[model samples]
Target chain A: MEPLTVPGMLPALEEIGRYVMAAAAEAGLDKRASYRLRLAVDEIATNIVVYGYQPSGTEGDIIVSSTIDDHVLKIALEDTGPEFDPRQHAMPDEDELTRPLEDRQMGGLGVYLAFEGVDDFHYERVDGRNRNIFVVNRPSAAPAT
Target chain B: MDVNIRSIDDITVVAIEGALDAATAPIAQQQLLPLATAGCRILLDLTGVPYMSSAGLRMLLSTYRQLSGKDGRIVLVGVAEEIQDTMSVTGFINFFTLRATPEEGIAALKG
Candidate 1:
C-alpha cells in the first residue's frame, strides 16, 4: 500500500480527498461507498488540521495509508499533532440534528457525519502520535444509475 | 468550484459545480450567506455538485438560519443521491425543500 504524507492544513484536504477516493475506487467500492469513504477521511483530516494543528501554529503532517482486505478497505491516518480522540466527542443527538435551522447547533455535526459514513472507526494514540483508522465495506456491484 | 448566481422570476438561483468539501465550502458560504441574509428567496442548484462534505452542511445550515428570520426560503435542486444520503443521515434533509431540477425548485419557491 502506498502512503501519502502531506502538511496538516485545510488546503491539503483537496489532495487528500482525491487520494482517498482513488484508493476507495481501487478497492472496488461503488460510487456511493467511495463518496462516503472520501467524506469520512475528509472530516477526520479536517479536524486534525483545523482543530489539532492550526490552533497551536505547530507545523505537523498527516500520513495516510490504505489497504484492501477482501471487500473491505482500511484507511489509516497518522498525524503528529496533539493526541485528541475524535471519538471522545459525543455525536450530535437526534434532537440536535432534527432541530429547526434557527435552533440547530453546529457542534459535533462534522464528527458525527464522519462516523456515520463509515462502517467502522477507531482511534489510537500510538507512540505519542494520533492515529485514526477507518474501514469501508465495498459492495460487489455498483448502484444502478 | 464554480458558483453562478442568477435570478429566475422571483427566485434567486445559485448554481454550483464541483465537490463541496472543506476547501470549497467556505467559498460557497461566502457567496451564499450574504444573499441569504439579504432575504433573497434562494434556490441552490447542485446538479454539478457530485459530493458535499460536512462543511457544506454547515454552510447550508448557516444559510438556513440567515434566511429563516427574513421572509426568505432556501430550496435545493439537483442534489446528488449520495449527498442526499448524508443529509438524511444527519437529519438536515428535512429542513430544505429538494427538487430534481432547478426549474422544479424555482417553481416550488415561487408557488
Candidate 2:
C-alpha cells in the first residue's frame, strides 16, 4: 500500500519513509533491504524538491508504496516541478566516486546512489509531469552501493 | 526534537535526538551554528538520531567547513549503521573523525 507523501522531507518525508518501510518490513523485507529502498525514496523525493521545482514551472508530490501481492516494492515519485528523466544521468564511476569531501562537483551522485539501491529504475515524463519509478524485487535483496 | 548538552574537556557537546531531515535540519543547523562558531571544539552526538537526510548532510558539511577553518573540528559519535552506510556510500565516512561513543569525542579533543 501507499504511505504518506514523501516530498522534500517537508515535514512528511520521514513519516512517509516510516510508513512505507513498515509495510515493506511487515511483508518480510529485511532491515538492509528496507533501509535501501527507503533511503532511495528519500533521495529521489529530495531531488524532486530541489530540481522538480526549477526549470519546469510546475510542482508535484512524492508517492511511496509497497506491494506484497506483486512481491515488489515500487517507489514512484511524481513531480511537476521539472522535466527530469533520471535516465539521462550516467551511473557514477566507482573509481572516481571518492572526491574531496566538500566538493560540490560530485553532487549528482544522489541519483546514481538511488539507481544502485534498487533492482530496476525508469524515468518518464508524461502529461507534463516527471515520474521516476524504482522497483526492487524480493529475491535480489542486496543493498548495492 | 530534544537536545542534550554535555561538556567534554575543551569541546562543548550537543547530542541531537530526533529527525535531521529537510524539515528539522534547518532547526538543527541553526541551533548548532552559533555554538559551533563561538566555541573551540564541537562534537555532535548522533547516538539517538534515527535518520538524517541530505539536507542534514548539507548542514553537517557546512559545519565541518566552518569548524575546520577555525582549527576546530566536528566529531560525530554513535553514528548508526544506516547513517554510517549512507555516509560511506556517499564517500563521507572519513571526512571527519568519527568516534564510537560520545566520550571519545572528548578524547579526540584532548589528543
Candidate 2, residue A130: lDDT: 74
lDDT of 2 at A52: 68
- Fraction of reference contacts reproduced per prediction? 0.83, 0.43
Q: Whose lDDT is greatest here?
A: 1
**Pairs that clash in candidate 2:** A52-A81
Instruction: Pick out the ten consecutive residues of candidate 1 chain A with the lowest summed lDDT.
Output: A136-145
Off by over 4 Å in 1: A140-145, B37-39
Each model's number of backbone clashes? Answer: 0, 1
In candidate 1 the C-alpha lDDT for residue A112 amounts to 87
Q: lDDT by residue for model 1 over B32-93, one digit each (tens)?
A: 98887555788999999988989999989888878776888888989999999999988888
- Identify the leading candidate in terms of TM-score: 1
The residue pairs in collision within model 1 are: none
> Can you tell me the DockQ of model 1?
0.75
Off by over 4 Å in 2: A2-9, A54-59, A69-71, A89-96, A104-106, A139-145, B4-6
Q: Write the per-residue lDDT of candidate 2 for residues B58-78, one digit (tens) a residue.
A: 778778767766766678898
Q: What RMSD value applies to candidate 2?
A: 4.0
